[model samples]
Target: MADTASQLMLGSGLTVVSHPLMYVKMLVQVGHEPLPPTLGRNLFGRQVYQLPGLFAYAKHIISIDGKMGLFKGLTPRLCAGAVGTVVHGKVLQCYQNQNQLEELGSDQKENSSSLDHVIKETTQEMVARSAATLITHPFHVITLRCMVQFIGRETKYNGVFGSIVTIYKEEGVLGFFAGLIPRLLGDIISLWICNTVAYFINTYALENGAVSEMKSYSQAVTGFLASMLTYPFVLVSNLMAVNNCGLAGGSLPYAPAYTSWTDCWRQLSLEGNTTRGNSLFFRKVPAGKSYVYAQKRFY
Candidate 1:
């Protein structure tokens, strides 16, 4: 029972952690409609209307989630949201690159808060969206971890997770939560989605009593449905964290430029990872370097 609770809590925490990234996603989906002046490009090609610099921010955030550390409580997330948004917004305003074209009146159009407007709006939207899901993510993280661990520690099956633990003990610990933090945050944002949909189902179930009678099965079913509803966060969070070098966030060393949440979503939708060359993650090579080094190492 205690184990179950922890898995639930940890799972939920991961979901909570993942919520912030999803905000970028929502903005990416609707944001293109607003930006008539932004020019963007990706691995595919040049785009006239694209999500600005939000993808870089998302990569940074995702990298943070991939590692193992004590300092990553919540401060990094808040800081990232606050600063990354402004940086991304300004960077997104491509008209600045056309500064030589300033006399054409494209750059002088900002009379209000400037490009920062989008950042503020986006950040607040993130907070609101994240806040909405906070109520549930922690529980899920703990629950899932506890569940897997319970089986891992006690069971003797030939499961892949179990085998991985046997082969790469350290990697195994990390892999169990390969995308741990982001997964949690993703779960957090997912509450908004799952709750909105499940509340009705839950109410219906309560009134029915059929599922309720088989309490354990019912709980499992609930967990299953919730997990399914929440997998989008899980998928994206995994992508971000898996590439991280076990530093501030689970960020990959080599990440492609991204425009916004839409780019992030579209990216993981096809290829779910950036790169697996984690050696460059924690260490920075010197100018004339034969090897890389790190002040602190996590594996």
Candidate 2:
């Protein structure tokens, strides 16, 4: 219980600190750029039009909605983080207990190889992660809509209970799970990719006595690589969370009303935006693509 409380507090603190950057990233993900590009030198020392980076985007939001506005969806996000942590812990504990019972009942534990243990642990983590995501997804949906509300200056999703009522009234219960599938898929795929790559590299590639010490960090390295590969799914999921959900940001000019998450994925792929919002800094508009900014204020 103490450990869980510490983790919850730590997770909430990180969420609060990271919310502003995440706010900017989400706006980027939804293709909302109220700020115009400025001429800046690229890494090659050539002058190029660079889209507003994190600080610029954050300042733009502050100008429109004040400093506190940077935390528009923070409440729900905190709730989601806390709930996810607790759910994952409970579910993982259950899985561990079950495994212990099975080990007690069977003699196969002694015969189980290291790879088998790795796979089993990975599978348990995947299951716990999926459950946590599924259970807390409603909070995720609310948090996303609340953040995207910045684009349209909509207050439809204000507080946690209020947002719940609004979603049920406007979009029904299904509204709470708008982007669940892709989020779950991204998480599961990333977990498997991380574990599989880590296992292979640690097992076969790290036979050197001194160099083998790096095996401890293999999972972290592979997890980073996996996140990079699965980032498009995350982008698509965030987009779907707000797509055509009766917000100006979800409509024409800001975004096309995507038929579904897959349709959103297809459109993003065709436009070479599968990796959009992947970077918070050094954003350069694609050559031949130009942005037209309208002088508009929602406040």
Candidate 3:
């Protein structure tokens, strides 16, 4: 209980600090670029058209909605974080207890290899993560819609309960789970990739002495790589959450009404944008593609 409380407090603080970047990233993910690209030198010193970086994009938001605007949707995000942390802790504890009982009753516990133990732990964590995600996804949907409201200047999803009522009226219960499938797939795939790659590197590539020492950092390194690989799913999921949800940001010119998450993926792939919004800084427009600035706000 104490650990869970600590995690919730820490997570809330981090969420508050990171909400601005996330707000800009969500706009970028939904293909809403109100600002035009500027001439800038790339890492190699070659001139290129650079989209607004994090600070620049954030400044634009501030210009429109003031400093507090950067925190749009933060309340629901905090709620989601709290709920997810508690759910993950409870579910993981339950799984570990059940595993302990089974191990005490079996001979396999004495014979299980380190790799087997690692795999078992990873599996348990993945299950806990999936459960947390499933239970807290409604909060996620609310958070995304609340953030996207900046584009249309709409105030439909103001507070948590108000947002819930609005979603039920506009989209029914299914509204709470608009982008769930792709989000779940992304998380599960990323976990497996991270764990598998980390295991292989630690077991086969490193010396036994170094393997023990590197074990702590291997998962972090591999997790970054795994997130890069599965980022398209995340982009698709965010877009799906707001798409056709009666918001201008989800409509044509900003975004097309994706038939499904797969359709969103397909469209993004064709446009060479499966990894859009992956970077908060140093964004470069693809060659031959130029952004046309919107002359006025949607609402």
lDDT of 2 by residue, 51-101 (tens): 899999999999989999999999999999999999999999998899889
lDDT measured at residue 154 in model 1 versus the true structure, 0 to 100? 29
TM-score of each: 0.27, 0.93, 0.94
Question: lDDT scores for all predictions?
Answer: 0.38, 0.87, 0.89
lDDT of 2: 0.87
Question: Which candidate comes out best when scored by lDDT?
Answer: 3
lDDT of 1 by residue, 1-299 (tens): 46435544564566457654443332232111111223345456644332234444345434644432111223323333433334433443443455436647664553332335334434444454444334323222222222222111323213333444442454434443444455556555554444333434544555555535644554456556766656565645434332322321223322343333345558755653222211111212222322212111111
lDDT of 3 at 47: 85
Give the range of the ten consecutive residues with the poorest summed lDDT in model 3. Answer: 290-299
Q: Candidate 2: give the clashing pairs.
A: none
Residues 1-299 of candidate 3 have per-residue lDDT tens digits of: 88988999999999999999999999988878778777899899998878889999899999989999999999999999999999999999998799889989998654342677778878998999999999999999999999999888999888999999999999999999999999999999999999888988988988989987898799799999999999999999999999999988888878888899999999899989899999977788775665442224211
Candidate 3, lDDT over the whole model? 0.89
**Ranking according to TM-score, highest score first:** 3, 2, 1
Q: Candidate 1 — which residues are off by over 4 angstroms?
A: 1-129, 132-189, 192-220, 234-254, 272-299
Q: Give the TM-score of candidate 3.
A: 0.94
